[model samples]
Target: VKSQHSERCIDFLTKELKVSNEKQAQERVLFVSARETLQAR
Candidate 1:
């Protein structure tokens, strides 16, 4: 039972990490685009 609980925890953590990583990637893309636009001006 304890092992099962740990497994679930790990799964949840992995999912959370994936979500955060995706968010960071999106933000980085946005930042780069904004910088490019500013430099173009």
Candidate 2:
């Protein structure tokens, strides 16, 4: 990533897409949190 891509690309892709090897883990966390938030309301 450091050698091939620019910093901007990394930042946008990471934050917007939440991409990487841990994508599944991150997605699960996001869904869990959303479910909790909805339940709270």
Number of the top candidate by TM-score?
Answer: 1
- The lDDT, on a scale of 0 to 1, for candidate 1 is 0.49
TM-score each candidate: 0.36, 0.31
Q: All models: lDDT?
A: 0.49, 0.49
TM-score of 1: 0.36
Query: Candidate 1: where is the Cα deviation over 4 Å?
Result: 16-41
lDDT per residue for candidate 1 within 1-41, as digits (tens), equals 54565455455545655544434444333213556679999
RMSD of each: 14.7, 11.3
Model 2, residue 13: distance off in Å is 1.5
Task: Give one digit per residue, the lDDT tens place, for model 2 in 1-41.
Answer: 33233444555456777775345433434212556679999
Whole-model lDDT, candidate 2? 0.49
Model 1 residue 29 lDDT score: 33
